[model samples]
Target: MLNMKVGESVNEYFARTLAIVNKLRANKGKIDDVAVIEKILRSMTSKFDYVVHSIEESNDLDALTIDELQSNLLVHEQLMKTHVVEEQALKVTLGESSGERGRGRGGMRG
Candidate 1:
């Protein structure tokens, strides 16, 4: 099983894992759907822990298909992207405010 990388997005990790699983299947290896589902859940980054927990609590892992899991993860991925954009905007706003203050202070000293 491919290990999920730090800061790796869900789509990337899912694609990698699915590739591995497909290779194993092609080689005539038997795969357990539940195990794959659990592995995906466990391999997720910490940021996805809450969503994973909610899924585990609300749904049966054995019954959930890979497509279903992917759909749910995609939702969270979008949310994460939105949050990152908001944070970047906030940082830029704060930086501009600080820059204005520094320029004003320089003017006062001159």
Candidate 2:
């Protein structure tokens, strides 16, 4: 499904979520800490479902801070990005290596 923050980075997603939170606070909305936390946990992309579950199971939603959640997701995002880069590099290396396998074998038969 099309969602904020889906295709966006964790930082970008949190930026959008926090903006809405701030606006609610500014308007004197009675949004409680648990409510805010739940909203964030629920609104995250499917990629973070596991992280969100871990946080929910391990911590008290009433005590978790937005900053903490954002960082948790951000770290995961960075790690996933690093892995993707590494995988791409490996693929390129393998492709080039295969193409050079017969380089010094006296060339193809005439």
Candidate 3:
């Protein structure tokens, strides 16, 4: 199992995995989808622990396709990135004075 390295994008990780799987297939390794899915779920970084757990609990690994798993992870990755950006923007806005602001979406923080 090739563990997803820290800071590695999901697409990159998937590409590397597919490459390895292809090589195995070329040599008649008889690898299967469930095996690949389990390996990926096991090999993800700790940041994905919750998502991995959710996937395992919610889906039948035997029936889940690799594409489906990749799509799920990609969505989670995008959400994570959006959340980080929102947090940083909130920090910056909070750092600025209220009077300097023209318009904002969020209401008063209490």
| Clashes per candidate, residues 3 or more apart or on different chains | 0, 0, 0
| Candidate number of the best TM-score | 3
Q: Could you tell me the C-alpha RMSD of candidate 1 in Å? A: 2.6
TM-score, structure 3 vs. true:
0.86
- Give the alpha carbon lDDT tens digit for every residue of 58-87 in model 1: 998878999999999999889989999999
- lDDT, candidate 3, equals 0.94
lDDT by candidate, in order shown: 0.88, 0.79, 0.94
Give stretches of model 3 more than 4 Å off: 98-110
Q: Per-residue lDDT tens digits of candidate 3, residues 1-91?
A: 5999999999999999999999999999689999999999999999999999999999999999999999999999999999999999998
**What is the Cα-based lDDT of residue 4 in candidate 3?**
99
Clashing pairs in 3: none
Best by lDDT: 3
What does the lDDT come to for candidate 1?
Answer: 0.88
